[model samples]
Target: MDRALGLACSLQFLGLAGAMIPLPCASHAHVWAGECCPVFWGDGSPCGAATGRGRCQGVAGPGAPAGSDFRARWPSYFFRRLCACRGNYGGADCGECRHGWQGGSCQLRHVVLRRELASMSPGQRLAFVRSLDLAKRTLSRRYAIYASVNATPGAPLAFRRATVYNVAAYLHYLGSKTVGTPRGPNYAHRGPSFLTWHRMLNVHLEQEIRNITGDPSFFVANWAWQGRAACDVCTQQLFGASRPDGRLYPGSVFSSWRSYCTNDGPFTGNMSVICPLGNEMPITRLNGWNWDIPRSVFRGFPSWQDYYACLNLSQYDTPPYDANSRFSFRCALEGFIDPLSPADWGIHMHNAVHVLCGGTLLFSHQAANDPLFTSLHANVDKIFEYWRRRNPRSRYPRGQVPIGHGANDYLAGFIPVYTNEELFQHSVHFGYDYEYT
Candidate 1:
C-alpha cells in the first residue's frame, strides 16, 4: 500500500496550512494524555513524552459562559490539560505525522489515494477487514466516550472505554445527538459544517487505523453506492451479509459487533432523557428489502442524475441554512430540498442512501454502529470534495448560524479543535485525496 506519492510539503495556500507549524515535529495535531503515555490516542499507539513525540500540558477554558451545554465547550467538559505534541506529529493522540507527511522523522509528504472498495485487490480487501476487526477489539489507550444523563451543564455524566472503531461510532453519535440537550440538529449536519465535520471524522478514523496497524498508507475505502440497487459491500469477504433475524452473518466479524446508543429515545420531543451508547442491539441492515420493514424508509440507491444535480448547485449556503436552506449546494448535498427541483421535499442523496440502507443505518444518532457507515461517509466526503472542486464555495456562511455550525465554532467531539473554516479547504490540506466514482 505504500506507493511513494512524492508530493512535498509546501504552503501554497497559507490560510489553510497556517496552523500546521514546522516545529521539530509539527503543530495543529494535539492530544489528551490523561494517565496513559507509552501508548497513544488508542491501544498500541505512540507519541509520548517518553517516546519524545508529546507531553501533557495545562490548558485554558473553551471560553463558554456558565450554564452552557457540556459539549458546547468540548474537551473543557473532559480535561483542563492537553497532550501537546512536537515536530510533524499530530492526531487526537499525537501518535502520527500530520496528514501529508509520513515516517519516523516526519518530513515526507504522502497524499494518500483513497479508493472505492471494489477497486481493492483480494489481499487488500482481507487486510482492510482484519484491520477493522483489530480496531473494533482494541480499546483506545486512555480515552472514554461519555454519556450525559441530562442536558444541564452540571448533570451526571457516565464514561466508558470503547474500542477504536466504537470510538468513531460514538463520536458520530455525539455529533448527531446532544445527550439531553435538544439544541438544533447537533454539530455535523444540516448546514455548511456538514461537509467539514464529516470530512474531519473520516480523516480522524483513517489516522487511527493507520496508527493501529503501523500502515502509514492505510485509508478508509469508500463504498460508492450510486447506480446499484444492492449493497455491493455486503459480503463475508467485505462487511458480511445479515440474516432476517437482524443479526449479522453468524461467523462474520461484524456479526460479533454491536451498535452504540441503542437505549436512548428521540429527545427532540422531550429533552429530559439522553441516548445510551448501547451494545445490546445488533446492526440490522436490510438493503432494498421492504418485506417486513415496519415503515417505509426510502428504498434503492440514488441515481447518477441525482448525484450530478447535487454537485452542480453553485451556492454554498443561503440564509436560514439549517435544513431549510433553498438552492444551496450544501443543503442539496445533505439531501434536504431536492437538487433537481428546489421546491421538492423528497430525500435525494445523503439522506436517501441512509434510509435506503435500512435498519441500523436508518437512525442518524446510531448509524455509525454499522461498519460501512464509514464507507458511506467516505463517499459523502468525496462528493463534498468533488462539489467544492467544481463549484468553489465559501468556507462557511458569514451571517450568524446554528450553535456548532458557525465558522469559528470548534467542531464538536474533537480535541485540539477544528473550526468549520479550518477544515473547509481541500482534502489535500489534510493529507489525502479521493479516487471516488
Candidate 2:
C-alpha cells in the first residue's frame, strides 16, 4: 500500500465524514450578482453588448499610489471601463449567469456541494483529474490576464490569453503581492481578509471549471487534513506524486503540466512582481514531512483539537488585525501564531499544511502551481464556514488594515467587484456548500 494512503485509512476529520451532499441554503435575503471585466480584454462581448445584461462603466476603488503594482485594487490601474452587470448576470461580459443562478435566462439555482478528496470514488476521481487537465489546457473564455512587453513594473499593460487554470494560479500570486507597502504585507494572507479572499478564489475556480466543462454540477473537493498525521493526498491516485528532483512521477498526467508565474520580476517590493507567460515552468511538489519521514511540526500534521479550538475564538479579528492579533480566529488559523502554544512561532493550521507541502508550495506566490493548494484552501474554506456558523452575529472588524484588505476593498485581482465582507455570506448564497463538517 502507498504509505500516504495507508497512514490515512485510520484518519477521520472531526465532525466530518467526507460525505458529498446538497447544502441547505441559509435564509439570507440576497445573493451575489455581476462579474468584473477589464475593457481591454474581457469576454470579447463588452458586457454582453446589445444583450441588456450590462454596460461598460468607469473603474471604482481606492486610489493607487505612484509606481505600485496594477493589481492593488484589482484592474483599476489597468483599465478605466469595467462591466456593471445586471441582476443574476455575471462574468467578464455579463453573458453568463450569476454564481448561484444558472441557465440562459439566469433562472436556475445551482448549488455546488464540494466533496472531500478521500471520499471520491474511482470514476469520480478520474473525471476530476481529466477535467482539471482540461482547465489547464484551455484558454480562459471569460477573462484575460494582464501581460506586458517586459517584466517592468509599469510596463505597458496588454491583455494576454492564459490557460483557465493560470487565472487561478495568478490570482493567488497577485494576492500575495504587496499593494503599496514597501515591506512584506500582502492582500490575502495574515489579515482579516484572508478567509474572505480565499473563499472567492475557490468560488472563482469552481465557476470557471463549470463554464469550461459545461457541467454546472461540477464542484471542487477538500483534503480533510485535521485528523491525518501526514500529507496523505500527495499520491499518484490523488493530487500527484513527485520524485527526489521535484518532478512528478512519469505515470501522472500532471507530470507534463507546466505552471505559470514561476519566477518573480525585478520590481521593487518585499518580493518582486511576477511576469506571466514567459515565466512558465514545470509543476512540482514534495511532501517534506510525512508518515515515514516524521520531519515537520506535530510529526508532519495538524490536530483536529487545535483546529476546533480556533473555531471557538469569538472575534473575527482584534486590534492590529494582521497576523499578530491574538484571540482572533483569523490569525490563529492562518498559522502566524500557535494558538495552543501561544509563545511558539509554530505554524498552526493553514500555513503548516502549506509548509509541509514543500518545494513549489514553500513560497506563497508559487504554491498554487501544485493543485493541492486548491484542495488545502478548500478545507480551509470549510473551516472558515464552520466558524461563521458558530458565531452567527459576529461581523467584520472595524479598523484600518493593509491595502487591498479593507472590508470593501476589491480582492486584488477579481475583475468583477468582489469585496472582503461581501464573501462573509454563507456559501449557499453563492450557490455552493461544503458537504463535510
Candidate 3:
C-alpha cells in the first residue's frame, strides 16, 4: 500500500486494460562489441588531449574567446579527426603526441580484441546464441546488483537517469571548457547549459550512427523503469498518485530520508531514495511507509533482499515491509534495426553480455570491475533505441518525461528550444547493423 507500489499498479492497470499503449515488440537483436568503459570523464575535458597535433584548422589558438565559433567547432573537429585515426590517442588537440601509442597517425600498438563477436558466421551465431541464452538464465537467478551494494555503507548506488544526465552534462562542460579535473587547479569551467550540451552529445552520437549506416534511421533505444508499485494508500493520498502527475522523481518514502539523500544530492548512495513531484505532500498521513516506526510492528527494515523475497514469496514474512523494489528494464529500438546496418548489433550484444556478466559475476564481490560498469552503460545506451520504438507515441519535454505541476514549464524554461520531438529523433549512441544475420 506504499506510494510507489500504488502508482505502479495503476500504471499496470492502465497498460493491461489498453488505456495506455503496450510496447510494440520484444527485443530481437543484441549488441556484441565496442568500447564498454566508464564514460570517460576527460582529464583535460571538452578540448581534445593536451599535447596532440596542432589545433583544428583556422581555429582560435589556446584560450580562445568565449562564444566564438571556434569554440563551437572544437569538439566536432576533435571527434572527426580522432575517429578518423581510430582514437589511438587522446588530448587537448587531435595530435600524435599521446603516450601508450605511437606512429604519426596515433595508432595503437599492442591491444587485441578478445574474440571478435562482429564477424561470426551463421553456424557461429547459432552457437553463440545458445551460449548467451544459457548465460542469461544463470544470471537471472542471482541477486540484484543494487541489493548487494545497499547492504553496506560507502557503496555507490546506481545513478538515476536525471542524475546521470546531470553528471554527463557536467563532464561535457569540463571537456569543452578544457577544464582540468573538477577539483584540480587552473580549472576554468563555466558550467555550460545542461540541456544544450546533452542535446549536442545526442547529435554527435546520431551522426556517428548515420556515418556507419549511410542511413539516418539507425538510432538508439529507450530505457524506462516500469514505474513504482501501486496500492490503496498511495492513490487515495500522496502526490504523483496518478500518471499525469509525473513518473520519475527524486526523493524517498520519508521526508527526513529524502532530505538526507538530496542534501549532497550529487553523491547520495541510497537507491531507495528518489526525487519525484511530491515534495509538498504531507508525511503525517503516511501510516505504513514512514521510517523510524517501531521495529516490533514491522519486525525489521525492508532491505533490498526483503523486497526481493517478498516479490517471490506467497505471503508477507514480516511487518513494516515494502515491495516496490522490483524493477523491469525496457528499450527503444527502431531506426537502429533498419536493413543493411553494420556491425553495431555485435557491439550492442557484447555490451549486454558485459552487463549480465557483471551483475552475476560480481554478485559476491564487494566492488564491481571497471570494465563491467562500462559495458553495462554501453548496453543502456544501446537499449535507448529499442525503448523509443516500443513507445513511439510517448513524448517528452526537453529530453525528459513530464509528470506534474510546472513539469512542462520547468523543462521548457530550462531548455528553451528543446522539445520531445527533437530529442526523439536522435538520442542513440550508435547505429545498428541488421547485417549481423
What TM-score does each of the candidates earn?
0.79, 0.83, 0.22
Per-residue alpha-carbon lDDT of model 1 for 1-437, expressed as tens digits?
00000012222111110111112222112222222223463334444666667776665445765443445655443445555778777754677677788876678888999888989998998888888889888976534555444343223444445678877886776677542334345577766788888898888778778878888889988888877777888888888887876567877788888775556544422223333443358778877545443322233467787788878778888878767788888887777777778655556677777766777887777788888888888888888888778866445686767767778777777765567888888899888999854
Candidate 3: lDDT of 100?
31
Backbone atom clashes (below 3 Å) for every candidate: 9, 3, 65
* Clash number for candidate 2: 3
TM-score of 2: 0.83
Best by TM-score: 2
> Model 2 clash pairs?
35-416, 36-415, 36-416
For residues 1-437, write the lDDT of model 3, one tens digit per residue.
10010012211111101000011100111001111111112334222323332332221112333331222223221112211112554322232223234455655342211122234354543443333222222321101111111323233232122222222222222222222232211111111122222333443333323333343342222211112122221222121132222221234222211110112133222222222212222222111232453433232212333222222322111111111111111100111100112211111121122222221111111011111222223233333433445556544332311111111221111111122234444232112221111
Error of 1 at 310 (Å): 1.0
Can you rank all candidates by lDDT, best first? 2, 1, 3
Distance from true location, Cα of 251 in model 3, Å: 44
lDDT at 316, model 2: 82
- Residue ranges of candidate 3 with Cα displaced over 4 Å: 1-369, 397-423, 426-437
lDDT of 2 by residue, 6-34 (tens): 00121111111111000110001100111
lDDT of each: 0.66, 0.67, 0.23
| The 10-residue segment with the lowest total lDDT in model 3 | 17-26
What is the Å distance of residue 158 in model 3 from its true position? 26
